[model samples]
Target: MVSELCFSDLPAEAGQGWPRGGEMVGITLEVQALQSYSLDPHYAKGLHAWFLSQVEQTHPRLSAYLHDGESEKPFTLSRLMGPFREQGGRQVIPPNTPFQWSITGLNPEVVDWLWGWSQRLPAWLELRGSPLQIRGWKVLFPPRTYSQLLEQAPSSGSCSLSFVSPTSFRHRGHHLPLPVPKNLFHSYLRRWNDFSGLPIEVDLFLDWVDREVTIQRYRLESVKTTAGRQGSVTGFIGCIQLAASPRMPELLRQQVQALLQFAPYCGTGHKTTFGLGQTRLGWLAAERVSTPRASQEEQIAERIQELSTLFLSQRQRQGGSRAEKTAWLWATILARRESGESLEVIAKDLEMPYETVKTYAKLARRATKNYQSV
Candidate 1:
């Protein structure tokens, strides 16, 4: 089938529309079905059924991500579940080979923890369509806390303050996941634009999947001080960075959802050849959820009030990098839903997996609960 073919060989028509230096790159990723499943498009006509079937047989570690808008919520799959899992992913994916799905979105803060998550995963993600893993650039970079940790994280308070460079750190790099500094992401973006010779727009997506509604939300200040309820999706963890077009958060959102819908067919063993495919496609646009609004103080206050009642009594926690990120994600999900934005538009803007974004939203429902007593 055309979809199964390596993106390298496209129909003759795909070549006709190309302009000089206007090539599209296909990124391959591995997805683990959160439920039982198949990608044989014809196996089941019902979308939800087919999707549920497709997510079958995930590793024990990965859990179900779904939600219901009810008083006493029980996690269950919804309409966008399957398409977001098995159908919407593009040939595009992460920057390395031997693709890894240990974490969904890009969050500067989670760099250290996510890399650690990648290393510890027992089995590679198992998907149906194309199996691959992102290899090579899998190095973990320094977190916002790295410099501070270097000075104070020592158990014995000894600062072997030798030459403060990556080379010196590498000798002792066993515990230091790839020595990239927090500023590395910034520097990399500049380099990427220069290399592609294409004007790039970046939209960092922030999705919070916290179920419990608490006025006392966690923040950078509440690390150990925060309290989480039983069904609370555990302290509002989120995913960030959706590359798409500027001003179109909806398109990037769709791409994330579609990528997640097609999740059943992608996995670590899924492999691909590294090269840019012709045609600008979606990746050419470069988009992300707007940093303009939520980053503003008054908007943050507005989101807190507009959010579900479960969260009304609690704080979204923007006092620290970790907590502030959670706040942004919650705000974005809520904002998009109330506005009734189109996933296709969201995909066009973010230049990422649309289904993947939906997956994040599905997980968000389960997470953004407004539990009262907890």
Candidate 2:
């Protein structure tokens, strides 16, 4: 049913005029579901896997770096944005329904790789077992180098950003849902430092950011969601207006403006690659409204958090990271099992040994029973 010409089958000139050679770029792919299918709440994980697989097919080394790099990730992905119906705790997309998915690359290597990949894009994006026919694609954010962003930043003005997807920061081993200005800039600054090759003094910049930047107004709502392999996240989706004090040095103000521009391409906070922290310029009032189906994942995440808290309190050795991780792991295993997921499937998803997951599930049961009996 895909009548459009595949990218590979097109003339070479068709790929021309597309943004290339920039240090950062963002693109949105328009796709339509070929058949009706139900998706898990955490289906962003599948998108993440599919992307890495595409990179691995041609540039295995780059894929390895993207997957294993300890540095700030040079890319981010957005969850599919479109209409869906909630059915039996899952999201169901009808056949031929259109969706938009965005990807951004922050470094020259990634940008170049994205450029090359886009030239020969596959006809379909395989999510779980469903195939979404790629309809068309376009650049979402203009391609620009860090220097260009710095040079082109407005000399003085307020900036507003919309967090289109749940955005959160990791603070002291827990999720911080509020977008405190210090944390917000620190998030963008981290990525800017990692990939820009133009390093700014962190303490100096962040100090200025904290002292100079003030939140003018905000409309935010917190939501619970699952991210990455094992744990749930509590994050915010909304918009905030920020401005620097006029008395601040002009250069520092420009840097602040530049970082705000970088936000859409670099994303705002943690787990961005797994669909958190999707951001864009401007105050998007419509996105602040919540949908009923969006709460399905929140419900599951809340349950996991509740179970984890209960298990953590029961641990005698609750002071260290080990205990915290164990509690969360146990809580996740038990929660999924309660949701009718088989132990084998849960173990595979969590990448834990089968016996270890089995044992954790048993331990979690005992802990719950003890608490209830008390």
Candidate 3:
């Protein structure tokens, strides 16, 4: 059992509505720069086994698969089409540990060591009492992975292991940089700064990070401590699953979008996207598609696919449900072929008034301009 835990005892989750039935598996993805997180319970009630996450701001989405000590690969979990939530079985997490911590009186060398490295996050895993039991590209077999995880997890009442800097995870690998780069990890650093509720006097921040648009704030709260350092520190946290939650699929979608946007900058440290898997690349859609195209039947279909792809590309992003969009599109097509049904008959069939039917068809025809290319 780990002497130092990094989280508090899960508040008596015995009867907490979500399942803990018959030994569950879990993959806790600790996002270093994540500012906020929550999941939809409606999605949770439908998970079978595995849960995946997208890497935020890293290349090829491979970082998520690169666990602290192993190569990239999928975990032994089921893959579902829609919702994806999994039950975290019994395990001990350090108690009263604020997600962010502050460190001072460092050996000066320590500060430099903790800066600029990609493997700064204090994370190590034991799939079976061994520090390197992770799977490869092959399908995994881990009936005991949960128990092994439990054994390795820190105790709620033990010394909590945490980094002093929010970007600590960014400093993995090296002990100290010969000449530490300032503002190098500005993106990851901001997350910890805000989480610690500590004061930041730095002038520079992450690239493209609009300080004018972003808010600056910090607050202190008591948290867990470890023998490796001093007592509890007042700090900050971006997202706590315990604070709020939502479905896995939707959550995954949002993460993928964020990852695609930020991956180029996020330094790699903790691998395997928190040991789950998959590098979801959220794509972007420009406002104009080839300066608008001719409005043909097939063209409409193509336009629908393009817009729908953009909307569904990210999990959380929505545009009327698939069913609704289909119904509306079909109705629109039929309306365009209005010659087949008298407006009055069309209204009766679709269960609307003659005028309403005519109006709908007219509106749909007009909206087509927005959907297609010139």
> lDDT at 255 for candidate 2?
87
Q: Per-residue CA lDDT of candidate 1, range 1-374, in tens?
A: 01221223222222222121211111222333333332321111132232223333332222132112122111111111112222231122222222212112122212222333333333323233323222212211112221232233223211111101011011221112121222212222332333323323543422210111111211110000000100001111111122322333444334333222212111110010000000111111112101111112223224433453333225555344444344444444544443344554433333437786566456545556634224
Model 3 regions lying over 4 Å from their true place:
1-186, 205-365, 369-374
1-374 in candidate 2: lDDT tens per residue?
A: 10122333233235456756899999878788877888776688889989999999999999999989999999999888778777777788788877778899999999999898878888889987778887777677878999999999987569888888889998998899999999999999999999888787899888988888899999998888888888799898888899899877888888889899899998888999998898888887563324334556777788899999999898887899998998888888888787777898788778889999999899899989999999
Candidate 3: what lDDT? 0.25
> Which window of 10 residues has the lowest lDDT sum in candidate 2?
1-10
lDDT to native, each model:
0.25, 0.84, 0.25
Provide the lDDT at 220 for model 2.
Answer: 90
Sort by TM-score, best first: 2, 1, 3
RMSD of 2: 4.0
| Lowest lDDT 10-residue stretch of candidate 1 | 269-278
* TM-score between candidate 3 and the true structure: 0.18
The C-alpha TM-scores of every prediction are 0.18, 0.93, 0.18
